[model samples]
Target chain A: MGETSARATHVQHGSHIDTIESVDAVFREQRKLSFAYGAVFFVVTLAIPAMSVWWKSWYAVPIWGGFTANYLFVSLLYYLFLWGLSWTYIKKADALDERLSHMADEIAAATLAAAEGGES
Target chain B: MGNLNIIAIVMVIGLTVFTVGLAIFVRRFTRTTADFYLAGRKVGTIANASAISGDYLSAASFLGVAAAVYASGLDGVWYAAGFAGGFIVVVLFIASALRRFGEYTVADFAFGRFGSSRIRLFTVVMVLLTSLFYMAPQMYGAGTTWTVLVGAGMFGLSPYQTGVVIVGLIIMFYVMVGGMKGTTLNQIFQFWWLWTAMFLVVVFAFTAGKFNYAKGLEEVTAENHRDVKTVTVAELTADDAALLASVETAMSEKGFAEVQAVVDAGDPDATVGVLIPAKNKLHTLRDMFFNEPGHRYNAFDQFSMVLALVLGTAGLPHILNRYYTNPSGSAARRSTFWVLVFIGTFYILAPIAGLAGKLIIDDAWRAGLAPANAAYVDGLLLKSDAIMPTLAQILGGEWLMGAVAAGAFAAMFSTTGGLLIASASAIGHDVYEKYINPDAPEARKVLVGKISVLFFAVVALGIGLGIPAVGLDKAYPALIAMMVTWAFAVGAGAFVPMLLTGIWWKKTTERGALAGMLVGGLGSFFFIIMNILKQLGHLPSEGVLAFVGSLTFPTLFTFPAALLTIIIVSKIDGQLPKNVDEIWMRIHGTASERHEKELGLDKVSTMFGNSKH
Candidate 1:
């Protein structure tokens, strides 16, 4: 088992040309997802203040269950939105990691095969 | 002590003993520095999530958020939203990277990243300052809890002083003995207990009060007027006197007589007759009871508060330290996800409790159930912090009050434990082990950490005792909440910009980090000082100084300023460390990749010897 693992590490080290690019691709993808989710969060949260300033009377307009839009939004819906955003981000980010790892392994195997073929 | 409720005292004692016992049980496992500091990096998602929730939900969340909601309606919910919203930012940007770049404390990370002792020292100062500021409010909350629970001082101390000392000592004993492993377990237990106790109180309140959400909303809103007692009257100018006369003329002659007598007696500001809310056009019953922003903040203030809270979570040292204990970067993200769930559940219940306090306790007080000396001003229960305890007593009698009181202690104790550990680690690990004695053994480092815990606890106790004497207790009605915002502002200003830049910007130099921290930390610190002075009447209250001082949280300005400073200074410095790329790889790379790079396959295999091949 030790000899097999050592040979695997040697192969991985010899064919590391595409690893940096693969890692960068994953990082960029993750950053984009984070930014997109972050923008949505900021817009929803900042709207509370914006509506308060620009449309003051809207607060008094009753919404569901006799709660004014501002009341229900601040008290209930805001928390729900946060929880949803987190759940989505975690799922997507984890998938991204798994994809990146798979890509790394495939790249290493292809590189190893090419190196062995060239040697033969 | 005789005036202290027996049930509350017993409950408080029992909870304290239970926490101490848990700490003692975990102490045997704490044999190494890693165990003492990061629990040997063995914390799982659920345990760490609960610990994070316990650490994060301080007295500010437990008591202050409810009281704010009770006082300001929807404006109060903004506090809770801002708090939980901060973690979203954490989940997106900071949590995983922080765990991957794992260090014992924030200062350690800064030092490792920048490879500068000066940066490390600067970070240590900021960490200590932020921790102390954060801990101060918890100490005050503990004091406030005792005043409501026991009603008397112990061992020649005032009740507030006695409470602060007792909490500080108990926390010190546990944290010093158990370290991270023990403290984390204690926090998990405390969080659940507090959550369950609060859950029970809310259930009881909803049932006992027959609080139909729609009807309660209608009932509160339909009563367009609130009764406010005159706590103090501003001196009446000629115009004011004219206004008073006109107001009095509008009232019945008998009602006017009471007002005239107070004005005639020369101290109109004295605690006198109640102001009929119907007389004030600005405070219609609809506005008083309905959710609105202007109750506590204008649009600008509301925006600034949300900004402070969202950015500030990234900078809190206690919260940041928890990320270091995760086994992998992925685990860190999972834990943050759980933190969001746990905290969201807690926050959802907070407003329920606040509404119950308003619908039940404050309503009863207005209906003549309040003690004669209990003050009500501008629709505010003066002892707003006591609303939860009062609600408990009214709904389910002494036993419920005791339960709620125990929860309050749990909130304070858990938060204090986290803060104490953060500060002690800064002093012992960052300052002592890293600088003073780099070759110190693990046992000696742990010993030093224990001493640091004791020293800081005493300091916190002293500052807690002085909070009331400095008149903060009177100047700020929501004293706990106010101090907490200050801590958040300082944290956001000082740490957020540096951490963000260090992680994302390759050009973040040691010089830039130091300069940004100074600009942000000291800028917010200055604002806090000015605000305090203005509140205590040392500064003019009606001019530019007052306006600047009134920007109680300077994060809205300081955060941008700090970010700008870092960008500009890093541009000017035009230098990056050689290892910046490697560090970036560590921060953004997978845990498997990191293991491959840092250790060969042999080491990796050895590290995961128990795992399946």
Candidate 2:
């Protein structure tokens, strides 16, 4: 946990610290980003099967030579979407981690000072 | 017996030797428990991603998937898509937090996050169950592959039994000796070999076999799909020959003539294999087609199977165990991203092999050029699991068939090796070190871990042998893929809900998570066993019991019910851990990674001894 003290109030890793307030901030931002991507993923994934059952044209009609939209999507195109979704998600997630790492330092210092002032 | 394919056998033997040799080579570096379990946590992003893909792509992906597509059409394609989508759940929800938590195993995560021995033991049980669930299919693949490659048994064991026992023992010995470091290295090497093998099959299909994806689909779908089955003479005649007459329409004159010979002999007890018109499960009013939906599953199963496949991936302890081997939270995400890319491409290729099998194998069968070792009814393989090797034999001759045979073993070896590690840690690390002997020496712990591997390998071997004995092999059209989905269903029920709630929902109490796991895990197991019984004719066809038993994949129900149970139970219990904030910080905090960043622990170049992790 990178914890230095017995009390579980804050985690200290060398010169850096993580107060509950700071982590809560980072968590909210992360939850937003992750859940947003998660929503898209679940929607897109479940949509294919939903289409298979309900949309006859999607499942039955051959758009390509022998390939129905369902076959083409499931066999080949779905993977393209997966690669695209995951690649963009990773880049965004990495960027979020970099930007938030700096913000966490600042937030930790401010939250710690405020907590100390309140205690005094 | 005299006509055994020497080339395929030699290739498989060569692969086993190389795998075992690699494990032995890494044995020296696997001294510490950390090294044995996590490769000392210094694995690079790309290497770790490849290992995860190897661990994730079992015989189910290498063989079962293509076989499924060949038999079930678009429904089979869902397996590849679902397997790949599973990592999305990992990346979006579990990967970073789990890595940030930096625990040894999933059981550790449960204990660490929830703070109780009860939940920890509960998680351990779930882990073992899921691993065993996963192991059963790999063992089945081993047996099936052996039947295809070797075609004979040693020590009076049947070909299937011989395959199960030998492959199980080989994996057990290697995993015990090599540990995680060995498993990791071997997984990377094995993954590339299988990936290349599948790639070669598809490439050969296009070039030598003159297979075109669009044209092939159109050609195969020109007629309604047909199914092959073995039925006793009594059963064939019991329905006033309605079923037998139906079979004549689907079978070729040559194939129907063979069926006629057995019936003409007037042997009531005689069993004959025949081809029959397939029923469209989804669209019962229409005929089943090769390139369309409803070849295998109905409308409900279309959704349930997808959920089972996608959600079940996250629940697999073996796959989740690989994430802990990554160097950092971001590295874990990167590893997962690359994992998606690698396996994504591999999955895309698997279905092509399945589709290719339809065209190439059928042509070969008509020309009398199909492999002699494989049994066929009306040009369709009696056993779809034989499609990969059989198709390869027709397309690229003996060498390609040899490569495919080796690939099948590699898939089983890499996956089973990973499962053994997960199972060992659940028992050796989670149970033994923590509860049985908290202060056990590192060497002793490692020994216990190896013992655990040996025990589970034996159990898995028994399950594989018992599958055919208990009539499970006859209960499903595609046994390997179906059985693997049972594991996925169980894992999806047992783990995904608990992990999702435990990680994302702060109010989640120990009682809630445990209850959720029990509901999801055992609920899935019950439905699966019931379904198996129904398929085996042990259950009546039209009752509540039958209704529940008919759910091929229970994840559609179990996942939601389990999630709701967690929410409801946690709300009622309302007992968060005392150090919830500290735990939350450990899970979501950035100070440590920042600190590690300054110290260069986040680098892809970090070596084993230099790292503090």
Measured by lDDT, the strongest candidate is: 2
Q: How many backbone overlaps does candidate 1 show?
A: 2
Please report the TM-score between candidate 2 and the true structure.
Answer: 0.98
lDDT of 1 at B389: 71
Q: Write the per-residue lDDT of candidate 1 for residues B1-613, one digit (tens) a residue.
A: 5256787779879998999998888887787777787777778788889999999999988888887777666677777888899999888988888887767888987887777899899888998898889889889988877777777898999888888999888998989988888888888988998888778778987798777665666556665434333334443325556546444533446555766676677764564543333332222333444455566565557788888888888899999999988777777888998998898888888877887777787566656664232344423466567667767777787788888888888988888888888999999999999879989987899999999999999998888989989988767656787788888888999988988888767679888888999999999999899989988878887899988877767887899999999999989997777666566655665634334434543121211112221
C-alpha lDDT of residue B493 in model 1: 90
Model 2 reproduced share of reference interface contacts:
0.92
Candidate 2 docking classification: high
lDDT of 1 by residue, A4-107 (tens): 12231232223232334444566777788888998999998888878866674657666554477888877778888998999999999888877876675665
lDDT, candidates in the order shown: 0.76, 0.89
Question: Cα deviation in Å at residue B557, candidate 1?
Answer: 0.9
- Cα lDDT tens digits for candidate 2, B378-472: 88998898899889888888899899999999999999999999999999999999999999988999999999999999999999998889877
Instruction: Let me know the DockQ for model 2.
Output: 0.87
